[model samples]
Target chain A: MTSLGRGASVALTDLEKSYDRVAAVAGVSLDIRSGEFLTLLGPSGSGKTTTLMMIAGFETPTAGDIAIDGTSVVGMPPYRRNIGMVFQNYALFPHLTVEENIGFPLKQRGMPKPERAKLVGEALELVHLPGYGGRYPRQLSGGQQQRVALARAIVFKPRLLLMDEPLGALDKQLRENLQLEMRRLHADLGITFIYVTHDQEEALTMSDRIAVMNDGLVAQVGSPEDLYDRPSSRFVAAFIGESNFLPATVRGMEDDVVVAECEGAIVRAICPGRPASGDRVLLTTRPERLRFTDGAWSSSAPQNRMNVTVTEAVFAGERCRYMLQAADGTAMVLKEPSSAAIRRRAVGERTEIAWSVADTILV
Target chain B: MNLVQAIAGRVLPTTVVGLILLFLIFPIVVVMVVSFSSATYLTFPPPAFDLRWYKAYFGNEDWLRPTWLSIWVAAAVVILSTLLGTLAALGIARLPPALRVVASGLILSPLIVPVIVVAIGIYYAFSRYGLVGTPVALVLAHTCLAVPFVVTSVSASLSGIDPRLQQASLSLGATPIGTFFQVTLPLIRPGVLVGALFAFITSFDELVVSLFLSGSGAVTLPRRMWDDLRFAIDPTIAAVSTLTIVLTVALMGCAHLLRKRAT
Candidate 1:
């Protein structure tokens, strides 16, 4: 069913988008591999959806070009572009039944009845809503209607699939179920999937690689693990998953590691790009990265120690989260498995939190 | 929350509504009562029952011809106004917000203007083009007067439909004209029917424009009624008026059914 035979990689070269002289996407260039689940993750007005719409051929770019299979598609109409789109509202034709709506694209291409019905049947089965083609859109629930819309979009098997918050309208349980179904569909269909959303967890869950956008520019593009472990920018570090920010000044550098001073607390981190001495930097670390200990720090251990007081200890089912404060009031968040031993370190207790230099990514 | 208190509260408003309804329907009841009067003049009640006036109206050949012509002219008006007004409403619905208001105002402006003004203008225009004594002049004059009402009803109903229905069709790969016929026309069917009914009734019941534009050789039913009223308050004219009232009530009933279908 793959028209391009596993689909050609999408590439945008110096793509710029502007509306009424206000730059929405600027000099943004990304090469998305074939059969990859790529999600453009950003907050509203951050140019993520604009980039998707531009790729879908709905909106014209003020400058630059987008190409599939190395062929530029500038000034191409949406219908002629052969790109499938799933909108946020699930814009289904209310007057048409499920069968007719799914068969619409096939009918447009002048496919014969037997062939069109056969294809529509297959599309319905793909979304697991078989034998319900006679129903109208309004008769179905939101999730059912969304599935029909999805079936309609992919019924013709377009070369590239563009989804703009397609599952954002569904409830949590249904969204999660559809997310897994969508991943399987992507694998089976073998088409390049370009999804856009502002939800960080959604970006991390279904995406093979995420392009985290900020201020009309791509802040970082990497796999979920790469983004979480080694974010290249301050925005990425803060945007994906939670992170504790420490205002610090670089004090020393040794073997890809740098020692920094956060208020009176000294912290060690891995800095991207060589840094000069006394440079002001943002020290970033995840909640799960820190370990609580009662002993003194080892001299040879590639870790730093900060004396902290657990101001708030919140229980989160599987994990216990401690909101700690340093002597100088620099806040630290730490998460640990809710073991009996961990719970014993109750709130308003003083302790030492330690983490290896590799756990931190200096921004 | 008291039972009798709440019941009384609702009944008082209903009582007021019933009073208003009586005030509005009294004139039509009086007209019907006087149409059957044995006396030659209109009164609250007849001294004796008679069918002579009804028989006289059916026997008059002059009234019969004009009434038949008026039926076909009103039908022509319905057909013309439905097509033109529906298309105009659809066109205006697609216009940008600022232009939509302007287009709607232009289309419905005739309703608020004086009908006599349109009658004089159409009379001179039809006479200048040698169409004054013909049926075409009556059709044209009636169509012009009825179109604004059609436009008003159509635009109101058209605004109630979902605009995304059109977008969904276009995305489904249907062309613009195909989408309009297959999707938009079906969704706006009730509006078109209502507009047509308004056009037909307005043209059929019209007297002012027909009086000005209609020549002596081409009198409509209302024109014939006017001529009959000049010499005497005859029972035959009252019979004709009663028939007209019945026809209107039936037409309005159909309009009500159409509105229900829309819902």
Candidate 2:
């Protein structure tokens, strides 16, 4: 089998789609680099799948243009676009044996018999199913069938590959296994991949870049660390992982840091976007960022501490989560690695929580 | 338990199913017995066994002519109805749900309308154009009756195929027509075969429409059989019935084989 050439870069300019009066994807513009594994991550009905369909050319944008490798392909049909897609259901042709299914694209292009057979065998080997060519899709397990689908999609050596939740139907263990395989395939093939999924952990684990979508619009697009550490919106902060949002007002700016007043206390944090003084904002921090003061409340600086009552504690083997309520009744959860010294505090016992100023974010 | 009690435990459902089976098979068995009878008139369990009626059925021009006519007419109906019904099913499957339901009901109206009523209506319409009793008229009428079966069967098969298969084929660089031929058609082969079988059988065994529409020019097998029953108790008609039973069983076996291969 021939290796895929240098991957195609895609540019979606002001892409939008609507079904009757309902907007499925609303005004999305994204630049995808060649050979990058970009994931469109979101909850259900969040327009991620629609965006992928638009890129695959199955969907015609209601208003906008799409270009592949600097050439506009707005009205082009999917077949002529030369892209590979793996559907959520796998969509392996049930009538064809595994070899025929993997060689379908080549067969359509009228590849000769001997060449086609050689390529089909090579494609099967790529998916680690070397001897499964004669078996029908129904005879194989779900994971094996999925691998066949992957083999079929990539056997044509298309410039781009799009996957719509390809492992959504498999069990957790199998899904994780396939996720690693997919990463290896992407690396080996070195093709642009635009994957759509609602599973945040899968997106975080496999993607070179992620575009977290919300309500038909892209909320944020960045690397996994960029999104986790510096989410630009409340929706991104909450959707990517767990977070605590505290209401605050911007007080002043100091170089890269912004001082904010939160819950009758002054908190200093790094803000990517500057806001005017007295502007209402949210102070966001991750659950793991918070730490127990170890009863030395007055030893630390006064501005970054909160006195709270422990309401509930859950022990989860390696880590413990403590639910606490501040003096004004704002609830927050703190997570720390489990240890012999850590014990469930008595219900209603007052405690102090603190975090580094660098970890706090003003959104 | 005693023998009576043990038997009683199974007797109720077993007896019910047995009666139903007997009710269905008894007439066919009697027809087969009479077809081999040595007697001159229709009778059950003749004193001797022979193939006299079978020989008569094959040798007689009146019976042989109509039998060939019915076979050709049913073949024509199968081809015409399968083509029309498969196209209609594909088109209807793509329509919006509300319109699809309405279109399906309209297409299937012949099955819901009384057969005699449809026959009379067709007779009235065809009589005006001097088309009554012609092979074309009969084939058209039977197509109307059989298209619904084809539609329902093919529609069911089309629905069973995941729509994504077509999308995947296109995404893998197959054109729309290629996808339909290579992916959609093979997946729906069993349904189409079953539908064609139903169309063929419906046209072949139809009696009421032929009774209303058949002239001396287009005497179907059932029309000739009806005439024979009215004029005389010919055991040759029994042989015809037996042949039809065998044909139907063979057709069913073919359809079953198709379904098995599809899965």
Candidate 3:
């Protein structure tokens, strides 16, 4: 789905941003590959948007260097940066028509009228809003306006695009539709996309790489699978997706797996020689990874097993979610597909929760 | 509700508003009607209606000169105040809250101070420079009174424009100055126009400063009218007043239309 467009490689080294003596983005360093869709994912005030702003040249970095295609652009002004940006509010010029808005960058570059009009028409077609060139932004719907903004940003064919929560204002269904469209556009343009969003799910769905930020620093940067399956910190594990974290004490090691005692239950995780015996760690596992022992092909020797009392059982269409409390009152959720040959556990029922070592990780 | 109480509830406000309107418009109406009278002296409820007074106002050179002087002075004042006020508003829009407050108060001080005090101060300053009776002095003095209205109008318009629109323009490869011209200037035109109108009317109707600054060649309409009031109570003065009122009303209507179009 990659488009025929050039992309630039961006690298930030030891970036530090502070406002009024308070650090907004502190010492962030990341390399963005050409044509890669990298998302800065974090909650509000977590410096993700600030980092995007810094990259867009709208915010001056107090310390550090940003290089585009191996050239330092630390002092370059925004107008000279040759980068496209879409603001959260869409920021379409209300006074200009759609064609004029898309043609603005070309006009600024002193492009001739004929060529500019052709490019604007192509941009309109690219955003699937052909014949909408004559209309003003106020005459368009929210979603259509958002598409126009996107079209305007890309019309000049900049090497890099920066978006700050571009779809945060749309409703859920439209947001989802646009999320797919954005991913497709990223692929089609083949331009490096540095997207910023507080929604982790959008980042996971669209980005080739996700930079999970906390406070003012990046907690982890990895692919979606890597971030989900092997989070480096507790913040990444909790922020990326749902996970039940249990305090564990390392017990023993066998091959690549480390055995640990979690509360009153024995747990095991696939470890690469990090946790030594007697070391404290947090054992985390996804709810869907756990299973009820009686329904599943019973594992004669599972790595982890705990006796739990079913506190609440909910049938959530696609999956049956069971909220269970272990013997030590540590709550855990076990999700099993409704379509699978699984027995549903009722509330207040006794059960045994089992999971293999491959499904858990110690952070 | 009973008929009397309901009628009173509605008719009371209507009657009060009608009385206030009558009170406010009565003098202007009387002046308009008296201006049309054929009598040579100022007399209401004349015996016959004639255009002789309007003819006298147009045919006379002294009255015509002052009218031309007022128009030119008001035009010059409008240009000066609009320029200074728009620039001042732009500067104030970017200033921090505390400094902006101080700046605004300083700029609007002329409006808050008594007109007579301002006029006396200007007269003193202009006399020192031998500019007491110059049109430039009159224009400068009028500009000081009119700038605050321009500032307030432009400031309101500037606030209405989203700051993000400027940021968006910058992001789209327009420089700050370019953004101001391309994005900001057009959006704030209504405010600037309103300010210009205010400056125009302020200079046209100004009497306090004009009384001190206007001389033989630079006499404004208001100053000439004051002279006529002191010397002769002619029906031509009434005709001039009717014309001034008409011009002011037409200008206000234009301002209203401009504001409506802008929104």
Task: Give a tens-digit lDDT track for model 3, residues B185-221.
Answer: 9889999999999899999999999998886658999
Please report, as a residue range, the 10-residue window in candidate 1 chain B with the lowest summed lDDT.
B163-172
Q: Give the DockQ (2 decimals) of all models.
A: 0.44, 0.84, 0.74
lDDT of 1: 0.84
For every model shown, the clashing-pair count is: 0, 0, 2
Ranking by TM-score: 3, 2, 1
Candidate 1: Cα lDDT at B71 = 95
Cα error, candidate 2, residue A153 (Å): 0.8
Number of clashes in model 2? 0
Error of 1 at B232 (Å): 4.5
Candidate with maximal TM-score: 3
Give the TM-score of chain B in candidate 2. Answer: 0.96
Report the C-alpha displacement of residue A166, candidate 1, in angstroms. Answer: 1.8
Model 1 interface root-mean-square deviation: 2.4
Clashing pairs in 1: none
Off by over 4 Å in 3: A1-5, A299-303, A339-342, B1-9
TM-score-better candidate, 1 vs 3: 3
Per-residue alpha-carbon lDDT of model 3 for A1-363, expressed as tens digits?
Answer: 233347999999999999998999999999998899999999899999888888888889999999998889888988899899998979998889999999988888889999999999999998899999999999998899999999989999999999989998899999999999999998898999999999999999999999999888989999999999988788898998889988889999877888888868788887755667899888889999888776344665555777889999899999988888988788888888897566677899987778877778888
